[model samples]
Target: MSKLRNGFIVLLAVFGFAFGSLSSVSTEAQPVRTAEAATTAQQITKINSTLSAKNKAAKKWIAMRESGRSYTAKNGNCYGRYQLLRSYLHYNYTKVNQEKTANKYVAGRYGSWTKAKSFWLSHHWY
Candidate 1:
């Protein structure tokens, strides 16, 4: 009876250790690509010329121009997560400029609750 109890305890301990090691290995092996990082990388690329002649910068600028205070447009339009506003449409001459400006603005408004609301009104994703 004593031997059986000791064996069962050893089995449970080994199982626990195995599972813990397996979980750690899996987590370490799995590349974690955040939705934001992936989306930004994918969306920031320029579209094909057949689709639109605009470069990545141009598209970003247009998105910013169209979006308003909440980084949303007049009609159900949301550009980037940053919620760039339409008021800044002509603010920058290039898309890269627009992105830079947006980065700065978002960083400044990081903790504001109104950030999402201002961008959510039209529910437009540009």
Candidate 2:
């Protein structure tokens, strides 16, 4: 009976320590992407030619509010500066992919970044 009690105590201690260690790891931490790993401004321009200057400003405005222009930003299942769904990115979290997908998304849903910005203004999200 004493041995059984000792084993139970040891097992409890092990699990308690493991849980404590794991709990200290923050799940909300946003990993920073190095400039070399992130998409370049030139690459963005290459793919971002469709948006007018006004629309580009609107897009940047929305990105600032959404994720502080982070390429690796995450919120629940949303990812990237635009906070698009991970599924929309098809599990590809690359910055270029995020930009492309966000562009397509805004175009399909709002027809333009300016329109999306208007929606975000009224709803605080787009």
The candidate scoring highest on TM-score is 2
lDDT of 1 by residue, 25-90 (tens): 988766555665566555535312222333333434434545532332334332432345545544
lDDT on C-alpha atoms for all candidate structures: 0.48, 0.89
Would you list the clashing residue pairs of candidate 2? none
Q: Which candidate number has the best lDDT? A: 2
Instruction: Estimate TM-scores for all models.
Output: 0.30, 0.68
How many pairs of residues collide in each model? 13, 0
In model 1, which runs have C-alpha deviations exceeding 4 angstroms? 31-126
Model 2: residues with Cα > 4 Å off, grouped in runs? 1-39
After superposition on all C-alphas, the RMSD of every candidate to the true structure, in Å, is 13.4, 10.4
